[model samples]
Target: MTKEQIIFLHIPKTAGTTLREIVYAQYAVDRITPIYRDERFMDMETFSQLPPEKKDAADIFIGHFAYGFHQHLSGNRPYKYATMLRHPIARGLSLYNHLKNLQFAGSEISFSELLKNKGSQFRNNQSRYIAGWGTQKMLETAIQNIEKDFLFVGITERFNESLLLASHDLGWQLKPYKRRNVTSTMWATNYADQLRNDKESMQELQKLNTIDMQLYEYANKRFSQQIASHFPNAVEKLLHFENRLHQAA
Candidate 1:
C-alpha cells in the first residue's frame, strides 16, 4: 500500500493544538512540517520549492493554510485532508478573546467595537480561510472542497468522536491529550452568560458570520452523516477511548 500523506488544515481556534499533539504522537517529528508559523512560506509555492528528498520525507503537512496545498506535492503519494469546524459565533468570540489575551491586533476594542471595525477576514473567517476568498461562489467552492477533498471533517464540539474517527481511518493510535492554547480571560470564562445577557450582540455576531454559519451547518451535517455511514461503532469506540484516557490520566 502506498503510504498516505495527511494534510491537516488546522483552522485557528478549532482545537487544533490538541489535535497536533495526537498527530505528533503518531508521526515522527521530522516527518511533520509545521507550515503555519512561517509567514515567509506561502503554502503550495514554498512547499513546491522544497527538495524532492524533503518532500518525500514529510508525512504530514499541517497549518492554517487553505485547501489547495495538496496540489503542490511533487510525487504520486496520495494525500487525505482533515479539519475541525466550530460554531461561527463561538469561534469568533474565542478568536476575539485569544487576540485580547495576547494583546494582539484589535485587543483594545470591545467585542462590539471590534466587530464594527475589523475587516471581513474577522467576520466569516472560517469560510474565508476554507474558500480562500469571501465570495458566494467561494463559499460554494469551500463546501465542494469539503465534500470531495477531505477524508474526514470533524467538529470541535465533538472532539472525542472526531479524534476517534480520524485515528481509525488513518490507522493511528491517538490517545486523548491535554488541551492547549485555551483563552484565559475572565470575560472568556463567562462568554456564554455574556452572550445570553446580550441578545443584540449575539444577533449581530450571527449576522456578521452569515457565510461561516452556513458553512458550519453544512460541515456539521456532513460530519454526522460521515459518522453514521463510515463509523457505525464510533460511540462505542469513543467511550472506550475516553475510558482508557481517563485511566491513563
Candidate 2:
C-alpha cells in the first residue's frame, strides 16, 4: 500500500458516492477513515486533534470535507488531495432536489426560495470546498491549490475517464464498478428540465454558481491536459475499461 495519505474531498452530489465505493475496495478496512454519511459531518476540529500515532493508522481519509482539510491531519506523512467537480448548475439543481426530498412530504422548495437562501449549500459550494473557504479571491486560490497541492481533480460528467485517469495517477489497481447513489429512480425530480423551462429560475441558479462555474471550467481544462500529458493511450484504455464494466454488468 502507498504510504501517502490520500484525502478525498467529496463535493456533495458530484458522483462522489460511487467513487467512494470503488476506492473502498482498494484499501484495507482499517486503513480507511470513518466516512460520515448524509448530513452529520465529522467534527474536523475534534478529528484534527487526535494524536499523531492515532491519525497515522489510516492511509486514506475519505469524506465530504473541504479541500484543505488535510491540513488538520498530523504532519506525519505525505498528503495528496483529490476531488470531483460537476457542472455547477446541474450540481446545484441536484442538491436542491435532494433537500426537497429530505423535507416533510409536500413541503417542496420553490425554485425562487432555493435561489434566495443565502446559506444554501448549492450556492457557490464547489468553489467554497475547492478554495477550502469563502473569500474574495477564492477562484485564484482554488486554482493555485489545485495545481500546487492536489493529486487529482476529477470531473463528474466524465466520471469513467476521470476514474481511470485517477487510478493511473494515484497508483490504484483498477476496478469495474456499477454506479451507486444514482438519482435514477421514480422519486428523484427531473429538475434540470424544469430549470431549462423557467428562464428566471435558471438565471438565478446560474448567478448563484458563477464562481463554481469558473472553477469547474478550469478543472475540465486541467483534466484534458493531465490526460494528454500522462495517459497517451487513454482512449483505448478507457474503451477497454468500459468493455470490462459492460461484461461485468
Candidate 3:
C-alpha cells in the first residue's frame, strides 16, 4: 500500500510534544514521510518564530504554527492534517505556570506583574507566550488555511482515542498511549495563585481564552454531529474503542 502523506501541525499547549514524538518515531522507521521542525516554512510574524530552514525538512508538517500555512504546504502532497486541542481554561493555566517557572530560571518579571499587565510584553516580544491572549487569532488563521485539507481534530481530554484513529488512518500498529515528560513532583498552581493575587488577571484569562473555548466546543459538537451523520452506530463504535483500549491496558 502507498504510504499516506501526512502533516501534523503542532499548536501550542496542545498535546503537541507527545504527538510530535510519535510521528518522529514513525518517520524513522520509514513508515511516514521525512519531517522535521523548520522555521523558514512557516512565515507568521507573531508568537514564536521558527527557523526558516525547518520547512524544507518534512513531508508531513507539524509544529507550532499560525495562519497562512496552506500557501506553503507542499502541493501534489496527498495530505492528512491532525491536531490536538486542550480546554482553553486548562491551556491558559498551563501557559501561565510554565512562564512563572521560567522566571525562576532567570526571567525577571513576576508572574503577578505579567498577569496585571495583560500579557502585553509577552505577546509583543516572546517567541511563544502563554498569556493565552489572541487564541481566536490563531484559530481563525488555522481554520482559514486548512479548509480544504483532510483534517482530523481531537481533544487532549480524549487523546488515546484520537491516537488510535490517527494510527488506523495511517496504517500503523496502535500502542497503548503513555504520558510523556511528566515529572514526579511537578504540580500546577499558577492559575490558582492568580485567583488569589490577581482577580483582574483571572478575568482576562477568561476573556483571552474565549476563542479557544469556542473552538473546542465547536469542534466537539461538529465531530459528534459528523460521526452520527456518517456512521449509524458511531456512539457504539466510540464506546467500544474506549472500552477496548481500557481493557487492553
Q: List the residue pairs that clash in candidate 2.
A: none
lDDT of each: 0.75, 0.79, 0.53
Predicted candidate 3 versus true structure: per-residue lDDT over 1-249, tens digit per residue: 114445555665566767767776566533333223455433343312434344333446565543234445434445555567677666666566656554444456655567665463323211122112354455555454344444566677767656645554554445444465432115544443554356676666666655556667766675565545655765576676678768876
Model 3 reaches what TM-score against the true structure? 0.65
Task: Return the top candidate by lDDT.
Answer: 2
Model 3 segments more than 4 A misplaced: 1-4, 25-59, 70-76, 106-112, 115-142, 167-173, 182-198, 227-249
Off by over 4 Å in 1: 38-48, 104-108, 116-118, 134-136, 184-196
Clashes of each: 0, 0, 12
What is the Å distance of residue 134 in model 3 from its true position? 11
Candidate 2 per-residue lDDT, tens place, 1-249, comes to: 455788888888898888788788888877878556544545566677788997888888888787767767778789988889999977876776665555423666677776565346867888888787756688998898888888888999998889888787777767888787665342656555666688888888888788889988889998999898888999998999889889999
lDDT of 1 at 93: 71
Span of 10 residues, lowest total lDDT, candidate 3: 122-131
For model 1, how does the per-residue alpha-carbon lDDT over 16-115 read when each residue is reduced to its tens digit?
9878888888888888887855674346556678877888788888888777777677666778777888998788777766655554543446667765
lDDT over C-alpha atoms for residue 225 of model 1: 82
In candidate 1, position 125 carries an lDDT of 82
lDDT of 1: 0.75
Consecutive 10-residue window with the lowest summed lDDT within model 2: 183-192
Error of 3 at 63 (Å): 1.7
